[model samples]
Target: MKAILAAVLGLALALPAAAGVTIDAFKTDSGLTVWHVEETSIPFVALELRFKGGASLDAEGKRGAVNLMTALIEEGAGSLDARAFAKARDGLAASFSYSVSDDTLSVSARFLSENRAEALALLRESLTAPRFDQDAVDRVRAQVVSGIRSDEKDPNAMARQAFDLRVYGAHPYGSDKSGTLDSVTALTREDILAAFRSTVARDRLYISVVGDISRQELGPVLDTLLADLPETGAPLPPVAAPAFDGQTVVIPFETPQSVAMFGQPGIPFDHPDYFAAYLLNVVLGGGGFESRLMQEVREKRGLTYGVYSYLVGKDGADVWLGSVQSANNRIHEAMEVIKAEWARMQTEGVTEKELKDAKLYLTGAYPLRFDGNGPIADILVGMQIEDMGTDYIATRNDRVNAVTLEQINRVARDYLKPEQLSFTVVGQPKGL
Candidate 1:
């Protein structure tokens, strides 16, 4: 009886560990990667398509062209106007959305299996046959231009933009993903069409479908939707790291609060130290309320409501940034505290307790990312785009768990030099 009770207790703890999700991976005939996860609890399905060339592919003067093209895709395509295209999805009770980032453009749709055919047809039209009508272009351009003007008045936006420029210089990632007002206005319909043809090629595409779908069922659907796209394997240009000219830029604004942004060049996604840097960032600032930055800058001194830092990993370059907003009078003091924390992380390194807790939170919380098919499919697509291996899901926690205190200390010293960093303040500072 004693032996049986012990066996049962051991099995109970092992159950949660064994209950993790499994994502099956495969590829299409045309070389597009596919990741699938099936859930029988509901009759819903989601398909996501990601293209390699995103905002980073924009031409020198055409900063916002990729974003504009993404917005215009659904405006008119394949025997449907913008309203008709929307009504088609609404009539089927399906959800469709498109988004652009520095590295990729994603189009996703979620709907019942019964409506997958019609929903996918609409997606195909949006991808291959966008009309780029004048009305839609003008409307979205106005909105974007208005947004640029709005950012001019926003101190936080100003600070972030200034920081990127200071760190990245002439690199594409250094520029705002959204083009400036002048560049956006200069973009013609021809430019949008040309960008689409060049960037959205089938060869540069990866598709992931999850929830109540199999490879056999999805293969023909994908073929039909993407059949018309050209197979031009236009390779992306190599993105070189931009030189960081360490300087402090102060943008004078009259707001009661000041937004402080400090930055330096960091690691790209494919770097060997990527995981180590990611772990270090969480301990430093990415852990939110549990992070040292928040503990020292906010909780300890009450300098601001929140202070945090992150690495913006891009296709060519990455940026390490720390930002906060506080009273105008407290801006300089807040900077001092942030600088102190950065310098300390570089010199003294993290405690065993700090490193242990960071690993615990990072590793233990990994399962939350795969709670459903939608998020799992999203991660799979992103992994494929970043050239991460399929086993990345299975091995991710182990990688985080393997980061040693020595590794953290080395990365902290190498990447977190406060004196070599650039500073941007977008409100009235006490001294300036």
Candidate 2:
């Protein structure tokens, strides 16, 4: 059945994309809002569920409780033990993945229309009746601990942690979501349960379903699948303040190359000039080899192999950030080049050609995101999370194209701060 589903998705991808996408939005009897795209061509359904409060909902000292609970969700449920749960899920050839980041917990599911009931029943059990048996908790906790230990020695991880620590201070975003070794070791089963209950309630849930489901079928489906969840989860954390000081901080690590994470403040998604900022980022550092940072730092000076930047507008905060790794000896030069480029953009902004190319690439690439049901479902959920309307799909390209060069340049001058760009370098290098 999985193979058949895969083949069906492949065929769907091969067909030409429709010019416009029609999304139907409705709420279930239980007041669960769901966005749906009914693609009848395939006998498969791709469903995505997003809960707003993610690892950030960890209770006091139980830092990684939410992450650990998410990992244990699929380990067992109701009457099914870990191995039994796997066997049953495989029997139906359904797929389910549960993941949590700092601000969101996501469940992605794929199943044939015929197996919908079984898949959703199994899914419900996982959500509302997770066993969190001692052995499964211990096993998954060990895996998470192992990963935490591994990250402690990783240079890139060092840079990220260092950067987060400086920017977020006491905010939950400052600490790693996976928790410290001691915190994970001390987490009790009750802690995991608390995390689960606090994170999985209905008020925080956003769902999107694509393929093989209709408005009528979806209402009962959502009610039956999700109505069991509590009415509300724990309150979300307070808004974070990202303090990006214009300073270069170094962590001494033994590595051939130094990894640098650099960033400053950024605009929110709903901000009116976000498209201009988005286009500006594409020209400045985000557009692969064509980006100004990549061209200057890699192609021109051969200072690094690759460099890129992006906007991260997390629910609590927003920032413009980028990374690059270079040999310890060349890292200083790379840092200087990146800073110069940052300042250059602020002073001169992007050329008309650069802005045009960014608009063209972004607009042209937007439609390709709908190639498969799963991707489309994921996109739909993300759009909803960003509070975008259903017409966003149809109007997105036009918005991208409408970003004038003057607007991007103005955003560049207003938002980019060379002096405020913080660089956290992780490696032992000769120079500053």
Q: Which stretches of candidate 2 lie over 4 Å from their true place?
A: 15-20
- What lDDT, from 0 to 1, does candidate 1 have? 0.79
Model 2: which residue pairs collide? none
> For candidate 1, what's the RMSD?
7.2
- Per-residue alpha-carbon lDDT of candidate 2 for residues 307-336, written as tens digits (9 for 90 to 100): 999999999999999999999999999999
lDDT of each: 0.79, 0.91
Candidate 1: tens digits of C-alpha lDDT, residues 227-279? 89888734675775655555667899999999988877788877767778888
Query: Which stretch of 10 consecutive residues in model 1 shows the poorest summed lDDT?
Result: 9-18
Give candidate 2's whole-model lDDT.
Answer: 0.91
Assess every candidate by TM-score: 0.91, 0.98
For candidate 1, the per-residue lDDT at 27 reads 67
